[model samples]
Target: MYELSLIALIMPLIVGLLAGFIGSKINKSFTHWITTLGIFISFAISCWILIEVFLNPFLSFNQNIYEWMSIAGFKFLKRVF
Candidate 1:
């Protein structure tokens, strides 16, 4: 599930990068299709995760990637969940 969540999170970034590079060297329509496909894939994964959460209400997904700063005992956490 976390893997799927990662894919859903990263798909658009990867797609946008590839589309930018490919579009600059090729046809615009091809780039459009590539981005659309990426979006669909991400959306599908998100929907699946949503369904899973609905079915199993006890499931939890939380990731603390970094603690960027601690200022005067206040912590800034970067989380992905």
Candidate 2:
């Protein structure tokens, strides 16, 4: 379970690094498109993960990435489930 979480975290970092590296080597116009596409892919994967978790709660996992300072005594946090 821990390993799976680690992999889930690392996967995005790896994709970002690879996209940046490849984008740097390409033309500026094309680089923007590549980056946009990467974001779309990530968003699609997130939606899919959400659907899977909704369909089968027992197999789902959640992670809290970070928190923001409280606003009006209300804390803000980012999480994945």
Candidate 3:
């Protein structure tokens, strides 16, 4: 379970890196199409993930990515939580 969650977290970064690398080698028109298609696919997957979370909240986990300390006396934690 832990491993699966870790994989889920890392998969997007890996995919994005690969896509960006490939996109850089392609023509502008082709790169635009590829990027658009990738974004659409990502959006679809995100919707599915949201629906799954709604249907089964217990299956999801919160991941905190970072924290920010503001000089305006505001402390914020950047998170997937």
Candidate 4:
């Protein structure tokens, strides 16, 4: 269970990197398509994650990847209790 959750967390990152690498190697016309495909794939993964979380409400996703706390000394840690 833990391992599956971990994979869920990491899959989008791996896909993004793989798609970016491929896009960089391709021509300009295909680059847009490749990057768009990557974005679409990531969006699909997010939708799947949302559905999975809804189905299994006990599993918690505690990842906080945004760094918006340092803007004008705004503290996020205190606000998210």
Q: Quick one: best TM-score, which candidate?
A: 1
> For residues 32-65, what per-residue lDDT tens digits would candidate 4 score against the true structure?
6665665676667667777888899887756564
TM-scores of the candidates are: 0.76, 0.49, 0.47, 0.46
Model 3: per-residue Cα lDDT at residue 77? 74
Instruction: Name the lDDT value of residue 27 in candidate 2.
Output: 90
lDDT of 3 by residue, 12-79 (tens): 56566766888667686776666566566666666667677789968856666776666677768776
Colliding residue pairs in candidate 2: none
Ranking of predictions according to lDDT: 1, 2, 3, 4
Query: What lDDT score belongs to each candidate, Candidate 1 first?
Result: 0.94, 0.68, 0.65, 0.64
Better of 2 and 4 by TM-score: 2
Q: Please give the distance, in angstroms, between residue 15's alpha carbon in candidate 3 and its true position after superposition.
A: 7.9
RMSD versus native structure for model 3: 6.5
Worst 10 residues of 1 by lDDT: 20-29
Better of 3 and 4 by lDDT: 3
Off by over 4 Å in 3: 1-25, 64-80
Worst 10 residues of 4 by lDDT: 72-81
Clashes by residue pair, model 1 = none
36: Cα error in model 1, Å:
0.5
Give the better candidate number (3 or 4) by TM-score. 3
